[model samples]
Target: MYRERPAGFARAVLWTSTTAAGAAPTRVLPDGCLDLLWSSRGGLLVAGPDRTAYLSGGGPAERWVGLRLPPGTGPAVFGVPAVELRDRRVPLGDLWPARDVARLAERAEAVPAAVLAEVAVARLRAAGGPDPLGARVAAALSAGAGVAATAAETGLDPRALHRRCRHLFGYGPKTLARILRMRRALALARADTPLAEVAARCGFADQAHLTRDVRDLAGVPPTALLPPRPV
Candidate 1:
């Protein structure tokens, strides 16, 4: 199950899961988000923004819970450039001091998913408020704006936007654009939209362009994403 964070951190999300028996590796596609996860057994870990699908391990007894923060928010909460954590899962202890992480874990592990968001909210408030422009930047880019257009809409020049995106999202605006576009495409594809129309609606130059973006960001073709399950 999953729910959006209900408090000050509007872009945050939380979810809980019980792994299924004999499950294949889960294909977690990139959406430019970062996850803070705790297992019933594995304790705490951070899942970074992935360029392509991350194949995660699975088993029946592996219960877990997580909070996901939007692209620019993790840095304020985690105190590191998003680029430094890209495509990796590191122990929370590795980022925070062991003793601090132990203390935080006591709080995190004791309550429901809501408390996890509260912890991040408190940390984020202490670091100053959430990034003022990150949402507008993500919205503009996800809506098919070019990097330059997104910069203009967000009042950032191209280089400035690229630098901020790299720090906050672990990639430049162009890559963020592609990832979000594939996300858009996948949503439409899952709804039974024909690939040609989806490509057109999502602003891909052609079906081939859409196919390449899917391959680049999801590690699959459009047909694979069209079905209810992973290929």
Candidate 2:
């Protein structure tokens, strides 16, 4: 069974099985975004930025895991019983053991799903509100605006900004900046804008920079990912 929780900024979907013994293994792939996954029974095996998955019926305790991807890899495989998860911005991996997640999933059957969603939203709000440095950095990156200037605006030393970002966001400031720029470029490319224009508008140094970033994060060239526009 699948349960959805409202995260406010980003929604979360939870999956669980009634008969844990009958649960099949699952595979989760990269979806070019960041995710925080928790397992109740088992642990998730993450194979680098490109591949990370869970083994269903593996766990029953609450273990939280966070993953951030920079793109550029095909779907990862999870070895177990047959299960597949797919999404453009979010991919699913093998269903492994997760005690906490399983408990939450089971709880959904008792309480209203919306109530659990509200709880998730509250948690996300608490975590996000307590941290300002990461948000400031993320905002600047998402805008494709000045990094140095934004760091200055936050009243943090350039190096300090880097340190805080890595601590709070689990990635370097520069890497986040590149991901944000790449996302902006993707938006433009999807709009049918020319490649050079997309690169320029998204603050990439050039088309090659855009290409490299896309390849690194999405495991495919920008052209390959962008759908052809109707003439």
Candidate 3:
């Protein structure tokens, strides 16, 4: 089964799958652009604007790779978990370079599941400890906690926090905080709260602030993205 939720910014989740689906993978680009790429259970290999291929796992082994992505001209795929792929905008070939999978197959198997799991755990630990900046930032944003207060709570200097955020999340601390705040607003919007109420509760300056942030992150107006309240 695969379920994806937009977690503010470009982050998302692809649930566990049992088979390798030859489908195009969908990703939110660095500039917040969204696109689909060819992927399988083995890993998610995608080429960036720089023409570099990146692979991340869709199964037990969460391995990632950075190399030249292969090209393919096919329909863009979406929605399926493992076995099937659906086409969307942009032909698959225009987006990806042709890859000789057989020749590069060995590199794909470089990291075992156990090793990957360990690495993930270790990385999580490090992220929470030495790299706790992202965690601290995420926590603060989730709780609507202020950046200054979060820095104090995490025992990190504000400047240090900023540095860590840039290194880990690709954005500065304030931007991440705003993104988190916007994420909360999206949740509240989906819950059918009034725009003003969502703005206030999410720490936005006002409804306009809420609208701007929501539109920036979700690619749609707040009203359009949010579902109607249950009658």
Sorted on TM-score, best first, the list reads 1, 2, 3
Model 3 weakest lDDT span, ten residues long: 68-77
Which model scores highest in TM-score?
1
Which regions in candidate 3 have their CA more than 4 angstroms from the true location? 1-38, 41-43, 46-130, 228-231
Can you list the residue pairs that collide in candidate 1? none
What digit string (tens of lDDT, one per residue) describes model 1 on residues 1-231? Answer: 223443445567777776667667778899888888887777888888888899775665676788888877788888888899999999999998999778767876777476667778888888896676777888888888898888888888889999999888888998889899898888888887888999999998999999988887878787886666555
Q: What value of lDDT does candidate 1 attain over all alpha carbons?
A: 0.81
Query: Of the candidates numbered 1 and 3, which has the greater lDDT value?
Result: 1
Cα misplacement distance, residue 108 of candidate 3 (Å): 7.7
Q: Compose the digit string of candidate 2's lDDT tens values, residues 72-178.
A: 11121122111122221222223434664455555544553343444445544554433445456667767765668878888988888776665444445676666
User: Candidate 2 deviates by what RMSD?
Assistant: 10.5
lDDT on C-alpha atoms for all candidate structures: 0.81, 0.49, 0.44
Off by over 4 Å in 1: 1-8, 228-231
lDDT order of candidates, top first: 1, 2, 3
